[model samples]
Target: MTTAPLVRRAHDRGIAVLTLDSPHNRNALSAALIADLTDALDAAERDEAVRAVLLTHTGSTFCAGADLKADGIGKGPGLLVGLIRRIATLAKPVVAKADGHARAGGLGLLAACDIAVASDAATFAFTESRLGLAPSVISLPVLDRVDPRAAGRYFLTGERFDTAEAVRIGLVTAWDEALDGILAGLRAASPQGLAESKAVATRSLREALDSGAEELVRQSARLFTSAEAAEGMRAFVERRDPSWAL
Candidate 1:
């Protein structure tokens, strides 16, 4: 595990900080990372001392979206759904702490968190449309958090925005500040209090995930399997423009 990129560290303040340490791929949500994150989240939820969960990353980019070049990319949509769901529905409050750029599905992960804070310099984009895919499954949690009008523009344009814009659009809770204070507040609360209050706070989002996830999964599978998406993803890996980028 010494060489593994995913780092799990439990703070004495009862916060489980899960770092997406694989900066080689900009911590792309590969199958392995997804599995590791899901397992870690489950463990945190069950840990008696864990009052909350903090999801963060290393390197300049929080996540570069999916590992477009991964071996099992075909199975990614379902796995992504599960990973996002796990974070959203975890018993404890989940907070996102980012000091880097996040794009595509990475934004989905941010939206699923109960609270998300990012550095003032961080940026974000919903690049799914450019990849010949839609933020279908992620839209479940994302739209729930984001302003409908702002989500419409970003989802369609796939344009990048700054952290201040992210906060304005409701994509993130705030610009990065004293996260220790936030964690301390959680630690001060009874675990059951935090859990139950979070449940109340996220009830609608959880329902949206549960009730709407199936069709979105099918939509994601269909889009990801399409020839258009293949070219887009290939172009992305090639660091070139897709054919449709005229």
Candidate 2:
């Protein structure tokens, strides 16, 4: 099978490195890219030679999020969700090496991992609200990683948050000057133990969401059509701040 151009996977030091490769577009998660990632993750999970997985990207961005051009929308496919679900449940650790802006769906990918290490320059945002779209698929993962009130603020505002704010909000586990050193430390730990711990933590959150799925959808539907949401989208397209107060 031909490898997808959007992702490249390699194994070394018992760690499987999955590099998001679409630098031209800041590694936007097009449907083809999502399909490739699903396959790559499945392969990594089945390979006993791989002890842990490290997700990173090639360009200045870790990921810019879903390809808005392809889908005319930002939601991920079932396979993408399944891949994230497996990352949470995997018997091996999954670490995110966030090197740049992890926006929208990209933030979802980081939250799905077992742990995340970001450079001092890394930035995060939940920008879908500004584009007349809801972060329906990524909402649960973001909520799990950050405080409820913080999630509400950022998700509603679609504002960019820096590394310090990301750390403060609990979106990332660590911020470091050298990403290599942090990955080295994670490599020294027991992959099995990390995997088990992540599974336990994420499973609980998933279960709670499952029980409240209906209410969640209803709320999002309401927000999607709200006048505020319309203004947000218009402001974004017009390249001006939203006049929401008016």
Instruction: Candidate 2: list runs displaced more than 4 Å.
Output: 1-4, 74-80, 177-186, 212-246
Measured on C-alpha atoms, candidate 1 has an lDDT of 0.86
Q: Which stretches of candidate 1 lie over 4 Å from their true place?
A: 1-5
**On residues 109-198, what C-alpha lDDT tens digit does candidate 2 reach at each position?**
888887787887788889977766677767767778888899999989889988888888888887855556756765777767666766
Alpha-carbon deviation at 117 in model 1, angstroms: 0.3
Cα lDDT tens digits for candidate 1, 1-246: 355646556665688889888888888889989888998898898888888999888889988788867744577877888987787778898999889999988888888889999997689999999989999878988988999999999999999999889999899987778677788788889977987898898888888878988899899889988999999888987999999998
TM-score, every prediction = 0.94, 0.81
Q: After superposition, how far is residue 14 of candidate 1 from its true place, in Å?
A: 1.1
Colliding residue pairs in candidate 1: none
Winning candidate number (lDDT): 1
120: Cα error in model 2, Å: 2.2
